[model samples]
Target: MKKPIILFVASIFLLFNKVYAQDKFTLEQCVSYALEHNLNIKQAKYTQAISEVNYSQSKLNLAPTVNANISQYNNFGRSVNQVTYAYSNNTTNNLNYGAGANWEIFGGLQRLNQLKQTKFTLMADQTYVEKIKQDVSLNVVNQFLLTMFGEEQVNNLTNQLKVSQEQLAIAKKKADVGTITEADYLQFKAQVANDETNLTSAQNQLEIASLELKQLLNLEPQQTFGIIRPSDAAMVEASKSAYEAVYVYNEALKINPSIKVAEYQSLASERAVSVAKGAFYPSLNLSANVGSYYSWNYYLPVDPANPNGPDYRPTFKDQYNTFLGKSINLSLNIPIFNGLQSRNSVKKAKISYENTKASEVLAKNQLNKTIAQSVADLKAAEKKYASAQISFESLKKAYEFSQKRFDVGLINSLDLNIAKTNYSKAESEALQAKYDMVFKSKVIDYYLGKPLTL
Candidate 1:
């Protein structure tokens, strides 16, 4: 029996160890995982790849092209041949084989312009993906901090409940000794009930927060995760200026992914104008080819008896020859007129370029506005947090004094309960303000291209 008990205990210990061994996701880990698996990041990467391919194709367009061709023809019955003037009634065959190369020495630098535009576009695409990553990281950070706050609030509420229980026990003892009135005991009981209700609400909030975090992680409903809380009394030290020191507005205009993409668009549009202008200039090419040909014919006259020596006896012929040569030819293509197509294309491209320029300007303006607003909100959250911290500190001291007074019978249960309730409210509000500050700060960092890490 002792051996069986030992085995069972060992098995239980091993199972607990296994459960704890599951990997824990830090903020960095979460962000990295999301970057690797997120749908938006994947799509952005694909778009970048397409841009790279387009750019490569533009460069390849300048390279030479080689081609080969073979053709054969047979003619029968009374035909005068080029090499020999004779009426042929049998059959004649001709075969030709050739190889050629065509290369454009120049296209008015259109290929160069296209390649440059594509490169810029690819860079923009890369930045855009980074921007999406920053956004996803921000979301993860917010949800992680929010979940932490909820957990802390729940713990605070639990502590408050414990204090209430202690006070209720003291009240019962005092009432039994005739030191406290029944009304005082009843008040303590009411306080305990209120604390219990608050605890339940906090628990519900924690559950919701957990579910939300799980959703963001794309995890199973039953999965359990943990978040690292910021260091103790962070609210006390988190000042307004320090929290808003992130260079969001300037970076948003300079480094924002959307802004970068807009700039790339403007470059691409400018290249389009160059491409249109290229049509006005001449194009040059160097080309070459090599091949061999063979032909065979057997002929009989149509007028047999009256004409050529008893219908020219059927003749069997065979010939084989091979020749190879190479030549370099420089060709120039000049565009004289195309019904003003090139001119109209240039006009359209110029218009599109202007539109892209305007869009880039708009993007910068919007980015600035977003950053400014986020900064303002962060500053406001800092102020609110400071006030909440002060309120919490005062209420905590008051609660302690009230408890001491009640212990000495200098304060009624009703007054002590009031102090406890006030302290709880202050703590909740402080936690809320602290979390709000964290959320807003993350948004600012995201815009600034400085996403939070572990």
Candidate 2:
């Protein structure tokens, strides 16, 4: 009884797992998963984090530096006392403590400019991370659509195979009743075999597409995966929406992370030039210090009134108060000569600034070109899909008419096969055109900063 119960429990568990594995995923879910698991996005985020730290440190650099020090000294040989400048033969012990602070009052605004440069650098890095995410999302979209197309092909072929098998069954019956020739009946059998082959090929293609999508999502090979297919109406509706190249370019320029990254980098380079130029200017600093010390071997003279009074050393508190000293200083350093390092730095910075400015222009030009091409492709795909749809519908009606004529012995097997072949070709072409149109529309949406769906 116990063994039977355990077996039943195990079977139930396996069934549950199978059901869970077969669950379908929507496009949004796939995109979200890729975003979280993609290695490139993770690396980009790490770089952005480093930029954040640098930005923080640059701001902190403007603050003053404070330090404290302490030391102990023991002298065993004769030495001159620091306090009395007298020779001493006995052992002497001394302790010292001090604290000081230095503040940069001026440095040609170098610190300020450095802060600004880091801020812009951080912004650029942040935008770069977003750019990586956008790249990953687009990749996911492309793969997802490809997998969907494969599924549609498989489904269409499966339906065709069913219809061929049904016709073959009818042909066999007619042949047995001596109403159809053996060649005609055999032709129906051949049609069914060919459709079976096509269906198998489509299924294999679908499996390959699914595997590629799984790799993109970083999923285990053994994992069972399926996609939530969008309805035909949804796809048609999405394709109907149109975008102009100029409008898409204008919108993309405003929100595209790649373009923003270049602009921010340019700003950072400009600030870096200012920071380098600051090295040629004079600098001012302020400092403050306070210190005190004690000696163990030194003592005060004996009291005259009490002639036998023991010689006494000053108390620690008293010594500390008596020996304490404080000082403040202000210094100015004028830049004169240093191997012309500052001049060279400023020159390099200017050149870098120019490079970044050129890069900014290049990025904008590329974006414009891409937007124009995408819009053109989308229009072409729309026209192709429309033409394919009409062709498929016409072929479908012709094939139906020919099949009916063949059923009544009015048409030959060859004529029926020709009509069927034409219809099948049209069907495949229509499916291809439909997916192409959808993908191109999605590309336009991506440039316009719209969310990708279906």
Candidate 3:
């Protein structure tokens, strides 16, 4: 019984460790994983692939179309024989085989223009995929930073709770000895309880933040996850950097996928207009056909002396060879008026092209506006973080002094608790400002087409 109990306990311990073990990832690894596994990115890539196929098919359309057909027919009751070109009273079987090819020599360059349009469309979709990747990477960065911030908050609160518990222990001893009043002792007890509640809340928030990051990564909920934290110095250094909106916008326009997507779409729409206009010009097509047929009822002409004798049907190969025909024809189609369809198509295409051009301009303008706003926000965040740091340091020193005075009976529990509260608020604000600054800096880096790190 004892041995069985020991084995069961050992198994439980191993299971606990397995369940709680964390899978740690750096920022680069998280982004890489999301890119590979994110459903949005996968869907975008699928669209890109479809565009590639369309482009390939458009290129293939420039080639001629070829088709082959074969038919067998049985006729009765004085039907006309196709091979003999005569009426046959007897039941007969006829077989036919043919192959034909048609090549468009010119259709006002419609096919060529369509090919160009699909090529441009394909390029646009490819760029769109890259744009989606950038978007996903930014989202990952946001969630990752939030999770890190939450962890810091939890840590800060936990330390505060420990300090409060220590003070409560001293207060309890002093109260029992009649050195501290009941109200003062109760204040210390309340402070400890308050800290405990705040710490619990912070831990819950950290869990929520981690959960969001895990969802973004498409990880299983049961899977423990952790991030590799960057150094404080690195984050502070990054926050100090400055960016000019004009410079960042210029850099963004050079590599921004969204702008490229719009530009390509505009080019594709322009080609569409050309394709539609091509319908107004005459089209030329060249077609070639080869065919032969044999009929079972077909017979050689009767001999004059043996008219009533047995009739001889021609052999299949002989008839096929003798009846084989080949023809090639060139056809020109002048586009006569047809309910103004061609004209209407051209007009619609032009309208669509104009819309695309407008969209391209809109994309550029939006990018510029966003860059300017991001630069301003980053500057503000830096200032906020700097001020928060100073405030946190001052309150921290004041809190330590209050604690020393309280221990020596120079101050009461309320004074010490107030100082602690102020310090906690400043610490929380500092953490918020620091992470906010870091995130804003990363946004600027994104516009500059730099790899997201830390």
Tens digit of per-residue lDDT, candidate 3, span 1-454: 8999999999999898776557588889999999998888989999999999999999999999999989999887888878667786878888998899999999999999999999999999999999999999999999999989998999989888998888889889999999999999999999999999998888988888888778777888778789999898987796678789999999999999999999999999999999999999999999999999888867775585877776788898988898899999999999899999999999999999999999999999999999999999999999999899999999999999998898798999899899999999999999999999999999999999999997
Q: Sort the predicted structures by TM-score, highest score first.
A: 3, 2, 1
Where model 1 places Cα greater than 4 Å from the true spot, the runs are 1-21, 69-98, 161-223, 233-256, 291-332, 336-340, 397-421, 442-451
| Winning candidate number (lDDT) | 3
lDDT of 3 at 189: 93
Q: List candidate 3 stretches off by more than 4 Å.
A: 1-22, 75-78, 87-92, 299-308, 311-316
Report lDDT per candidate: 0.78, 0.90, 0.92
Give the candidate number with the greatest TM-score.
3
lDDT tens digits, residues 1-454, model 1?
8999999999999888667545566777777777777777788899989988988888787788889999887777777553365676767776667789998889888888878878877888888888777777787887777777778888988888897898789789989999999999999899889889988987887888777666666666676666656564553344234433335566567777788889888988888899889889999888887765555543456576656554442322222222344577888899999899999999999999999999998988787777777788888998898899999999999999998998898988888888888998999999999888877766766776674752
User: Candidate 3 versus the native: TM-score?
Assistant: 0.89
* Distance from true location, Cα of 57 in model 1, Å: 1.7
Task: Write out the backbone clash pairs for model 1.
Answer: 78-88, 89-300, 105-284
User: Number of clashing residue pairs in every model?
Assistant: 3, 0, 0
Candidate 1's error at 15, in angstroms? 9.9
- How far off is residue 104 in model 1, in Å? 1.6
